[model samples]
Target: MVSERSSKEFFAVTLRVWRQAGPSASGRFVDYPATNVSPDMSFLELLDVVNDGLTVKDEEPIAFAHDCREGICGTCSCTINGKPHGPGHGIATCQLYMRSFKDGDTIIVEPFRARAFPLVKDLVTDRSAFDRIQQAGGFISVRTGAAPDANSIPVPKDDADLAMDAATCIGCGACVAACKNASAMLFVAAKVSHLGLMPQGQPERDKRVLAMVQAMDEAGFGNCTNQYECSAVCPKLITHDFIARMNRDYVKALFKAKFKPVSSASGGAG
Candidate 1:
C-alpha cells in the first residue's frame, strides 16, 4: 500500500546505540548508519528504519521499550547524548524528532542509569522501584460515595494550581537519571505534594509522607544532593520546589511521631 514516491524528505544520520544481550550480559555501543530517514519521522521511527535493515541482514534488532508514543506513557525512556528523553525540553523520548539533529550527525543513545534501575537489555531498564514507592501510600483511601460535583468543595486557588502542577508527573525516571546522586526525591515529592494539597488526601497526609519516604530509601535510591538536576531534565517540567515542600512535611511528621502527650493514668502508674 506504500510507494517510495510517497516518502517524505529524507536525510542521513548515524545512530550510536547501546547494545546489551541481557540483564547479566556485557554491553557496548554499536554504530549504524540510517540513510534516507524522513525528516518528519520521530526518533523512534528512525530507529525502525535502521532495524528494518538489520532484519534484512539477519542481525539482532535493538531491544527497546515503548508504549503510547504520544508521550503520556513514560515507557519510552532513553538517554540520548547523556540526556534523559533525548535533547528536547519538556518532552519525552517519543516526542524527539529527527529534524532536531543535523544531517550526517551521530546520535548516542543509552538506557537510564541508576542503582535502583537495573538494566533489562539495550535501551531498557527495569523501573519497578517507582511502582513499589507508589504502592507505599502514594494515594488516599476515602469512601466518598459518588464523584462530587465540580467545585463542590471550596479549595484555595493557589493550592489547586500547585496540586495540578504536581499531578503532571508521568514517572519517567528522568529525574533519577539526571541527578548525580540518582535521587528519587523529585518523583516522591511530586506524588506526595499533589495528594497532600487536596482535602481527600488530608486524612493520610502524615502517614503517606512517612511510608513513601521510607519506601524510597529502602529501595536503594540515592539522597537528594540539592543540585536540582532532576528538575532540569523532567519532561513535565516538575520543579524541585516540591522537594522542599516534602522535606518540610516529612520533618513535621517525624516530630509528630516522636512526641506524644502522656495519659494522666499511665503517668500516675509510672
Candidate 2:
C-alpha cells in the first residue's frame, strides 16, 4: 500500500536504451532513471543531462551522434518512444521538446535499425549505406566547360515545380525508418527525380536511375509497397510522385535499350 504523499515525493521516468558495445555484440535495452528533468529541455539535451549524470558516477556515457545541433544536418537521428526521428511529427529527434512529454514518461531511445544500417556502436549505426547508393550514380556527370545560359532551355512550370519538391530531401534515413519494410525508395527517388527533371541531366538520366536503384537493392533495403509513410514523416515533404517518376524513367530506359536492335545485338544487357 502506497500513500499519496509518497507518490508526490517521487516522480520517476523510465528510459529503455538499446545498448551495444560494438558491431558484433548483441544489444539489449538498459533501463535508466531520468532524474532532475526540466520540461523545457530538448530531447537530445535531456539525453545529454542523463549522460552527464552517468559520467559523474564514473559510468560510461551513452554514445550517440550529433553535430550542428541546430537540426539542419540530420546527423542526430534517433527513434524516440517508438516514433522514428522522435515524438514531434515531420521533425528530427533533436527538435523534439521534453515539454511535449509528461512528467513520468517512459521514453525508449534506439538507433534506426535495418540490415543496411548495421550497429556501429551504442546508439549509433553506420549510415554510410546511403552514401554507397548515392555514389552508384545519383548525380549527373559535370561537363568540363562553362555553364549553359539559363534561358537556353525552358522547362515547363509544372515539371520544374514538382522537381523542386523532390529536390528538398536532406538524405536523412527517416524515410527508411518510417517504412515497415525499411525501404530506401523515397530517398533514391528524390535524388533521381531531382536530377532527371533538369535539362542538364538529360545526357545520363537513364543510366543514373538504373545504377541508383541497383545500388539500393544491393544495400539490402526492402521494396516500397507504396504505403506513403515515407512522405508522411519526411521533414522536407518529398512526394511519392518522385518514386513513380523513377519507375517511368527506368521503364523508358529499358524500352529504349531493347528497341535499339543494332546495339542490342552487339552488346550484352546492361
CA lDDT for candidate 2? 0.82
TM-score per prediction, in order, is 0.91, 0.87
* Clash totals for all candidate models: 0, 0
Kindly list the per-residue Cα lDDT of model 1 for residues 40-159, writing each as its tens digit: 788998888788899999999998888999989888889999999988899999989877887789999999999899999899899999999999999889677988788887899899
TM-score of 2: 0.87
Model 2 misses residue 208 by how many Å? 0.6
lDDT of 2 by residue, 1-270 (tens): 222232234345777899999999998999988976656567788789889989999988998878777667878878787667776766777777666666678889898878898889888888898999889987777777988877898888887887788878877788898899999999999998888888867898888888899999999999999999888878777888888888899899878867865643666665
All models, RMSD in angstroms: 4.4, 6.1
CA shift of 28, model 2, Å: 0.9
Off by over 4 Å in 2: 1-12, 145-157, 261-270
Q: After superposition, how far is residue 2 of candidate 2 from its true place, in Å?
A: 37
lDDT of 2 at 44: 83
